[model samples]
Every structure is written in structure tokens, then in C-alpha cells.
Target: MSDKRRAFESPADLARPITQPVLRRPAATTMGAVLVVLRVLAGVWWLLALTFSWNDVLLDDLGLGDEPDFQALGNDVKEAISSGILNTVLIVGGIVLVIELLFALLVFRGVNWARVVVMVFATLSIIGSFVGWWLGGQEITVHTTLVTLALDILVLLALSSQGARAYARRPRERRARGSVA
Candidate 1:
């Protein structure tokens, strides 16, 4: 047998770093940044909403105070339960924000699956917003609605741009090339 080893059997070949192709388009970079910013803004919005509305909306207005079993409980016990519930909500919300931020980062890295996920999330958010407006029976503020809609639209537009599409496609093309060879 020949002393020469096959390229695939070489340790160096296996250890070689696979470099990601750089995104050359400005639009792709901008879209990635915008998606991340949108996620950050969403996290901030949730924080503010929870901070401002937790006590009044959750405990008082929602009649957490008036639950028949809660009525018989001592004030200290009631306060503890309410505090526990609020803490749980905050923790869960924080987890969600973190997850959203991670997904945003993935999108920024030109992952096509991340782009699809973000698009799906944006579409769901838009649909949920409309459904809430119609079924919630609460007055919807124009400013909030407009801002939400604008962000969703902009995200969709940016991700759908030709430059962004090309950036996302690069990895798939690379994979195909490797597989063919």
C-alpha cells in the first residue's frame, strides 16, 4: 500500500476551522442590527409594563384581593402569596426576554432559520395585537399600535430585502458545495 493518507483521514483536515463567509451587503448588517434593536425595545417595553401595572392591574383591579379563600387569609399571608405570584411572573418574563434576545443574535449572524423564526414571530405578534384590540374590549392607544405595526413591517421588509436573502443563502450554498465535493 502507498504511504500517503486520504485527505479525509488527515487530522489537520478534520481540525481545520470552517470560516463563515462575511456578509458583504450593508443591508444585511443593517437588518441584523435593527432586529436586535427591536428585540431590546420589546424587552424594555415588557419591563415597563410589568413595573407600572403589576400592583394595580394584577392585585387590585384584577380582584386578586377579593378571592374568597384569600379573604380569610391574614394580611401577611396574602401579601406573601401575591408577592410570590408577582415574582414568578417577573422571572418568566425575564426568561422570555432573554430567549428573544438570543434569537435576535442568531438572526444577526445570518442564520436563515433565525430569519424565518423572527418573521414568524413578527407575524404572530401582529395577529395577536389585532386580536387583542378587537377582543380585549379595551381602548387601544394609537401611538402604541402604530409603533408596534411599524416595527413589524420594518423587520419584514428588511429581512426580505435581496441583500439579506443573499446573506442568508451563503451558508446553504457553502454546505451544498462541500457535499458535492
Candidate 2:
């Protein structure tokens, strides 16, 4: 009882606190930088496709023809342009183009949110491209399609990295934890 009392009277020896996480800042920075670069490049590519092929893609092809019918294509394009779908497509597409350009700018500046937005849109765009290719049954070279798909996948993977996601989550993370990430 005396020994117990003496031991109890002595100051308690608490376990040492857990060590802080040794953050790999360099790795995070490198990954984040790569994601930004990929985002900018992919965004520019997408913007160009959206701009140059807007009519050919949405109007002349999908809106008018079954596949390679020039007459149907012309009629559809003419009707679309005259019947107001052209203006609607142009307006919406213009807005998207401007937003994408802004996103590209932000990504170049290492903005994580812009990277996330780019990734989302890039993924959707790639899917749409695939669907269009399939529907049109256009005889594209396998090598070209494969290369394009591979590049798109790489961009997506880079943007979806832990570091990129973490950076993007910075604001929300900070808000949730009541401190800056």
C-alpha cells in the first residue's frame, strides 16, 4: 500500500505525444506543378477544339448528318444556323471557351481549383469525343486515337494526384479545421 501510494504520489509519466507528420513538401510541390502544367496544355487543346470545331462538331455533324452525307450535313448546318441553334451553340460555347481560357490562366499560376475544374472538363470532353467518334463510325487511325487517349489519360492522372487534390482542398480543409492547410 505504501509503495503504491508513493508511486501514485510521484508525477505520472505520460506517453510522449505523437510526432508531427514529416510532410514531403518537395514531392507535393512537384506533383502540384506538374498538374498545373498539364492542365494548361490540356485546357488550351480543348479550347481550340471547341472553337475551331464548334460548327463542324455540334452543327454540321451531329446536328445534321448521319455520318458522311455531305448533302445532309449542308442542310443541317444551314437550318441550324438559320433556325437559332447556331446562335445558341455559339453563345454557350463562347462562354465555355472564355471560362476555359480563364481556367488555363489560373492553372498556369498554380491555382489548384483551376486544375480541378480543368480535370473535370477534360474528362468530360474526352468522353464526348469518344462517343462522337463511335457514333460517327469515322475511320480514324488506331494509332492516332490511342495516342490522343493516352495523353488525355495522363493529364487526368496528373490532375487527380494526391497533391493536386490536397491543394485544391486547401480552402475547404482550412475552413473545416478552422486553420489554414
Backbone Cα, N, C clashes tallied per candidate: 0, 0
- Name the regions of candidate 1 deviating beyond 4 angstroms: 1-23, 142-146, 171-181
Pairs in clash, predicted candidate 2: none
Q: Give the TM-score of candidate 2.
A: 0.43
lDDT of 2 by residue, 1-181 (tens): 3533232322222223223432333344345445445544554565556556665666465655444564545666666654476466557756765675576556545566677677777688678668868897754354234444555567577656555444443432136565655
State residue 153's C-alpha deviation in candidate 2, in Å.
Answer: 3.1
For candidate 1, the C-alpha RMSD (Å) to the true structure equals: 13.1
Clashes of 2: 0
User: TM-score, each model?
Assistant: 0.70, 0.43
RMSD of every prediction: 13.1, 13.1
